[model samples]
Target: MQSPLRHGRAALGTTIATGALAALSQAPERASRLFRHRFPTVAVTGMTGVGKTRLADRLSRRASAEGTQDVGSAVMERRTRRDPRMRGYRFRVVPGENAATRLGALDEVFHDEPVDGVLHVVAYGHATPRRTAGTSGAGAATREEQLAAELEDWSITAHRIAGMAVRRDRPTWLVIAVTKADLFADDIDAAVDYYSPGSGSPFADKLDELRALAGGAKLSIDVLPVCAQGGGRKSSMPEKAATELLNRLELRLAQLSGHV
Candidate 1:
């Protein structure tokens, strides 16, 4: 019933409004891309039973609230996560049960995208047992033996990462996340010092080797203690420690991204 001029004006107005809405919807994404640094991709890696998956789940906002379930050997594929606190950053978890799978996961990550950093998780003699009954040498290893084996695994992983960095000719950041601090809550300082670089620990020696392998490639390394499941399983770490850990992690990620 409307006149042709009025109908045309109405149509034009509708078009203009829709275009404006579309632009407004896209503005956030555009602004993010413009102001944010390149997406920082980090790989969470360590020997099996070292709480890598749990730590990843705890940091990621998208992870289920029910908690992460245990996996056999290692996760079949790398799981990616994004923390709300770490905007424009991605954390990828790679399996590390054995040399083949560990190296393969790292290769897959490098092939898929350039990694900005790595979180090498360690438990400092409190990692869950990897073997069960009926397996040869199962339960025979003492805690000291287990820790030694894990340190050996760390050496291998570090060497592999250094090789990858040298090949890519890119600077890499490594954070040794000493997980399960709750187990040794009484002597947390000793636990941290044991893994700290230049502490004269075996782990420190391996870190020196990693640096040597990295050669001209810039490698920044840091050691941090974390209790991923604070308040769970009679955890000695208080909730405050968990909060502080997250804050420190956020600050470290920000620093790596040059946001600090």
Candidate 2:
């Protein structure tokens, strides 16, 4: 079935990059400066099943109606067709996992490559355990405990990345994308509407706490709600996630140019 909503430009390829450049070209000074360096790289990372692979598949224009399988540690590059100078923009997707491996992967990105941004993809659904027989306790307690654990995991990821950003000589931006928002559409007016304080979702409260943690570490950070998969009951689409990611690339590239 055809989607009713028109996808905003497909996956930041030539046409989209050209359009982005056109917008930046309006300010010739910035455009000229920004194009002087090789394109920046952003890494998509998070816990397993948080939708990192799906996000990468959609961004790479490889998404299908059903879904995409997990591809570990994939590297894809994009360059503006009009100008070779704006070349080598890359997205290196490191498979999502818990704190044990997330930190190691992040450490590599920071030390091994000159990464301009990091996309920390997390899912709201992680808080809700899958239904099964012979459950351990009341559903609410289970959910609450699940959310708390998720928060701890996310905080560890954020703390490690923020620590790297603070100590690294070069500057980097961290864009936190809360994925799987569509699954909870009824509860949230927007992606994060349910994540707000007092919303009773530990995920929301923890997200708020993450910001303070970032500030304390002095890392540039921003968070957005995204449905990488379509916006239906358990639907998956990457249009919004792709658009937001592209926007972040443009913004981060420009910022990095000044410091370069």
**Which candidate should be chosen as best, given lDDT against the real structure?**
1
Per-residue CA lDDT of model 2 for 1-260, tens digit only, reads: 43544343344366779888888777887764465355556677665556676665555455434534432233332312122443544566664543445556666665565366777776665533332347654234354455555576666666666655656665566666766665654543554554454455656566556556555344555556665555433344445544654455445545643422
Residue 212, model 1: Cα distance from true site in angstroms: 1.9
lDDT of 1 by residue, 148-203 (tens): 98898887777668767787755788888888887888887888888877889998
The count of backbone overlaps in candidate 1 is 0
The lDDT of model 1 is 0.74
* Candidate 2: segments with Cα more than 4 A from true spot: 1-38, 64-88, 98-103, 126-146, 169-171, 189-218, 231-260
Instruction: List lDDT for all candidates, in order.
Output: 0.74, 0.55
Best by TM-score: 1
Give TM-scores for every candidate, taking all chains together and pairing residue i with residue i: 0.74, 0.55
Cα deviation of 78, candidate 2, in Å: 12
